[model samples]
Target: MNAHPDTPPASLPLFLHDSVADAVALSAVDSLAPLLGIAVKEAEKVVLKANECAAGFTVREILCTNETREILRELVKLLASYAVTKTGMATCMTRTPTLDPDALRKRFDDVREGMRLHELLDGEQIAAVQELFAKAEIAPIRFDTTPVIATRRRGLESKLQERYGDYVRVAVVDSAATAQALLREAYPVLLVADADEIVLDEPGIISIPEHAVADDSIVYPEFVVQSFRAKSAAIAAFVQLVTEFDERKTSSLLDKISIPDLEAVLALLAELARDESAHKVNLADTVLSWEEAINQEARFIAQTGGGADDFKAYLDEAVISMADELQLAGEDRDLLLESAYENLERGPPFEFSRAHTIRLQEHYARRIAEQRYFRLRDYATRLIPYEEAVNTALKRLFYLDFLFAVARFSHEFGLTIPEISSDGLGVIKGRNLFLVDEELKGGETVVPISYSVGSTDLGIFGATPLPVAILTGANSGGKTCLLITLATSMILTELGLPVPAERAEIPLLPLYLYRRKMIKKTGSFEYSMRALSRIFMREGPKVVLIDELEALTEPGAMGRIMAALLNHLPASTRAVMITHLIHELRPHIDLKKIRVDGIESEGLDATGNFIVDRQPLFNHIGSSTPELVITKLMSRVRKAKLRAVYREILQALEKERDAWP
Candidate 1:
């Protein structure tokens, strides 16, 4: 196959090279799979392979770059389509069992032996005979000797003799005498029948009489007559069997069996008859030996300048001497003579102008080229171990396709590869990466929150990086989103992929996301806490994400319980905990060991919407009071009693106004 002129060929590196040192699992991949638009099984494989840090990072960078990404995208789609086409072709691949070369040679030898009576003929005549024999289905004879068949054969012979011959004869002449008689004929001898003719009405046989010619020499006619004496002899031997079997009824009965079974049975019978039968012409053998045909054609091409007109003309004339030497007599010799003459008069034409000859040469040249091409094609198919190669190619293609998918994902999420950090993770202006489909959120701008662990922003918390942080904020004020952003960024970076942030520093740690499992059965909270304890104790510098501390137990007790859990966890662990009960847990956690962050709602807007600042307030002490909730709810309280209760809530807010700051 030729390469497309427009395409610049490139060989892409394998996505997962064996040289990679580290391979880690990213827990976030389950959530991230849909973002990449891949199945879970595929996503898992890609993520695991990509976690082989070095190569993953290199491949990811290569694919994620703007120019390379676009090129790979088109390449992937093209390869995918080609792979599908190959798959379809494989499904449609069918083969007919082939004969061995030796078997094919034997078949040709047999055919030649059967047609040997015609050896006296020219090359053109011999070639024609060979071609006709190739077409004949000469399986062993199973003569259907029903009355109907016999009658039909008789009628056919009668019509052939009547139409072609002007005279008829029924002679029991010997071979030499028969030849002598033919030498005496003036008019052409059309057909001759011996014992076979007797069965199909011997009276209808056709022949011509002897006549005198010039110079006391005999001139033989082109036409000859033949008898089916061999076939007649076989029929006579099987006369009892032929009489007993009714062809019509047997055929109808065989048709009642399933087609496949009937065919199998008939094939077995044919094979049996071929082994037993003596009459060769009655055989129904239609199997074309490809090897025989190819070898024969090759030999012919090597002769006579591959069928030049002069060579054909010479063969047509030269074959007469061969005919005169043949010992075959009577009907057999006549039949061969008839076929030879027929072939000489009209067979494959060789005469042509120089230009036409050149054209023919070019055509055969192209054909030879194509024949070699197919031969190589078939040889390669048989010789090469393709299963392994196909699998390897498919893996490469899949990797390319996946890389493109990630490119598109990164483009949509506005992602970039983050600077790797050994200590822990850090991010600046990081968006909520889990909210992959922004439009689904009804046009709400995804709040980009900036916070860090194992590193601190200089402006707010100074340069000292903390390994643990407590995120406390107003309900629905985006603390969970912020925590998710940090964790997701780290996960993506760890996977050697891009993070959805302006700037990020990530640690290569096994990440664990600790969230309350919502089990319908009772005592699930205790079970979850115990699991959390076991997870927290695992060796770190690992990062852990905790959401909604209240889900662990009763809200009033959760603050103390969470505070205890945080304090007991390994100091080497980096943790982010999102909780609403910040004030309750504050006194229990050692300030020197953890950083405190919060999402603050400055106040409500004129429309009663809280003007919540989505940014993380680093190193801050802030509480989300019920004041805004009560204020927003005041309008919805319609009953007079509820209004009075709302007034009391307002009066209490007034009393606490001095301590609001």
Candidate 2:
């Protein structure tokens, strides 16, 4: 089955298990997660889940593996040389604010009712009212609502007037004609209609829709107010993150992210960008308040003395210039100048009679502040419709980071996506990652080895594939390294990550690596047997790797035990055991039932070192060649008697070699 589009793939398991490391004699520091460059906690969680999945031998469909590989490949190609580590995927996961629809609905109702009753709005309510006006693209103004009474209009006007008092005028009219009369008188009448619509296309007449009136008063739509009010703290954070990503991303990088959820986020960001462009406003252009503007002007005036030319320059640069930009009405400008003059006279003294200039500056400052305030407010109000979209965009960014990390890991390792097979395992030109640059005592470079088990279709081993095999070799001919290479390939394949191989085909199965242990205690052999038994008894097909199992017991007994175990193993299971007792094992088990592969050591080179091929040869048993070791040691010794003794031993072994298998 295909995975859900919304669900992110499990983290790529890049780290080798400790058992695998020990079995292969790898250094303790080969972990892949830290190298992945994953920044957020969410990405870390994916890695953790992937590790768990690998341990459990969880099987995923070939379709899912192929799909994941495609995503990684595209990411690698698009993000080539664009290192995520350069900017450092900083922790961007933050708590998002939540909106309660019920609370917002109630707030709208309460504020509308308070406005209709001519009740002075509290600080919070006033802010809400201003927000509503901004969203509706209207300037906020004080106004009162009055009902049109058809009958018993007796004490109605008096009762309404008494309730509203001098704060607002309440004129109870008998018809729309009377309301029109009020509008004609320049009273700025807000006409509210119930069943009968009283539409008026006049500037002063605020026409309330028939459906928007409740109890003969205008009530703005609750849903519209709710939408505006729901621009919570989370939306602001999402905007900041989106902006950052946009600034760093190239068009090519963006084009490569075609995952459904990520595409949805990018699309929403585009919509938000369009909205911002349509209603662009710069909050930095506005001062906090008129008072703050006046203070700033005062400071500048104080710095430059009261010379007429200086004052004129100040007025042109700071006052008239801004007044022309804001387009303040002549009447409003005159009124604000008059108020400033009055305040100046009653306030602190200046160094000179700069009162007139100061008043003009204050007027322009207040007008500019008002203009900028409304612009910013409108911009914020317009974005409320995208609160939920912004939240989703932020959430998907974390998943994007996870994918990017996977891509970087794949690119860095030169890994290949393996084919998932129903049975058996194979790897072509596989190099053990841990041994890539490690300095060996022989000063030899790591050699890539190709091997196959359990399936003839892979074409590495001849006509028939060996499901169970004994791996034999010279003392240090990379027997353990071959096992680790296979284990790494299997684990990486299971986790849906590219393996460190040119090509690989792996079956999904639980992995067991048994490393050699030098425990010579009395019960060590029994303990080893019990551990091996438990692994075999587990009720599932699995891949097992054993390194020098003969170390746990006598060579004769170990060979016999392994031969019996190999013969009894389920046909579906695949196992490889590294042992020096293959010769002894050959006598106890049928060669047809169990195959023996060898890493052969050719005779000494001119440098007096054994030339060994690390890749195992299929269906071949290799000699340990202790005589070659003795000859090398003999050349290093200068004592005549010891060298002569080695010569005699070598001659005796040469005679015995002819009688060997």
Candidate 3:
């Protein structure tokens, strides 16, 4: 069940801050100890795929990006506490190379020349991979360190080039690459301080002189160090956004600040926070407060007293109004308001008012988010100056002939870094939180083409959008790869990494991979089925990707099992499935089909086998007005086909339903 080590994957490293976030993450894992024990009772080959990458950074490095290290340590400790019969750790990383001195000057010049107006590419590739060792934490996994080292060095080359090389050439020629070079070294270190690993190495893979390799041919145009054109443009856009903000223009979205609403909300919160418990249990006091509350609409709290509904009703309306002020319209906005209301009803400590609770929670969540956001924003901001620096790095990389190699450096991790979001990634990976993609590498095919195979969207609108997708697609039709790509892509996206695609937007991560093969030893059809079932049934608030959902057994039985899965799947994850039971579970399948087109019956000839005369079809399902109602550009392409494809698809689905298993 091991995947090819060299598969290409673009992943965002997990941040395992060495503090509070880590404590929370570890505590969450500790919560699963009992559950994990139940799973390992009969299973074997226990694999704990943790955020080992974070562990890769030397402890000396300032660890504390969302408290990763302590969380990782706690996870390992908990796993050890589990007393699993057997277990191991594994990770996949892209190989990165490094360079130096005399090698430096040549790389500098090449990157400079390529950035000239027309040429843009990854700098000359002087690729090398190092031993990215994942030291034994309590002992399970080992990460690939060499690749990280290589990439890190490659990143730093620009800075080295600029400080010792030429700034004029860096600025005038290929600016993007020049910018990239300056940041490369620093980025890896950011990982060291922020993440669980350093898959990209420092001075490991850098742009050198194209002369070192050959001509501009060796490096890609995008990697050209002198490509300053785009950076200048981005600066303009940044300036525009700032100017608009300063000018109080609508485009600036400054209205979002809502000072008036904020004040109203704070006042409401203060009024609600009143210690109504001290007010009274006496009928006269109740009457007085009730009368006052009705007129003034003040929030009253009684720890075990009365008036729950009265307060809930009024607070609900207030929260709704606050949401409206924030411009949260439609369902999403409504849902947010409802959530705020529900949170209020649950009430905070007796000291805080329902309004105050909601306000504080809102503020705190925003604070936490803002804190996280600022960290990333800071990183991005620092990156701008480097865009200024790529020019020089490109020249160095070109001279060293490592351009193209450098551009793809960010994604060099041979293994797709699973963007595991909810809970620490270790839980999903070890506890069999169902996952689809592992060896999947549709790469280019999956992206630009938007080909999804056996893909199922498990999002529930009233609930969690994207439910578990139970996929069904023909073999060799890119079914497996599609599932893998989606599973990993979603994980990556959720984790906040730009996945390998034309463009991808998804949830965050601590991606876990569960191979169907691992559960095989559980033996019986029902036993393995239940074992797989157990994986999803464990603690949730996590996404599940199940491949060959039916391969566990009989079609009729599988249909029933799948039906149960569709119905019982955790409301947390948006699951997608890949199965051949498309026809069997057509009734249960609430997903669209992404199939290969060009199946000309004429082309089938004697074999009746499809001979692809054209590209694959990217067809989504459950998309009529309801689908249309839910869209905002994400489903643009799918929505466009709705006018024509909608009814036909509906009719086909109706017909297919009649023949379901």
Please estimate how well model 3 matches the true structure, expressed as its whole-model Cα lDDT. 0.32
- The list of candidate 1 runs beyond 4 A from truth reads 1-378, 381-400, 440-442, 456-464, 516-523, 623-625, 634-661
Model 2 C-alpha RMSD vs. true structure (Å) is: 19.9
Give the worst 10-residue stretch by lDDT in candidate 2: 90-99
Which digits, one per residue and each the tens of the lDDT, describe model 3 over residues 6-55?
22112211111111122112222221222233233221111122222222
In the predicted model 2, the residue pairs found to clash are none
Whose TM-score is greatest here?
A: 2
Measured on C-alpha atoms, candidate 1 has an lDDT of: 0.43
Q: Cα lDDT for residue 648, model 3?
A: 62
Q: Note the Cα lDDT for every prediction shown.
A: 0.43, 0.49, 0.32
Clashing residue pair totals per candidate (backbone < 3 A): 12, 0, 150
**Native-structure RMSD, model 1:** 29.7
Candidate ranking under lDDT, highest first, comes to 2, 1, 3
Work out the TM-score per prediction. 0.43, 0.48, 0.29
Model 1, span 1-661: residue lDDT tens: 0122122112211211111110112112332233334564454444434432312233323222222223233333322232222211111111011112333233223323322323333566445433332232111212111000011124344443332222222233435445335423311222333334432212212232122111011111111100111122222212222233343133211123232332333333344345334322110121123223333543576574665355445544433433343322344334433443443444444212233334333333333333333332333233223223222322222222233334445556677667666666777678875464453345677877667777533233442477788887677788767766776665455334567788787665555565433322334777666656655555545567777758656776888988887787675777888877766787688777778776777777888788888887777644465766876778667888988898898777545432322
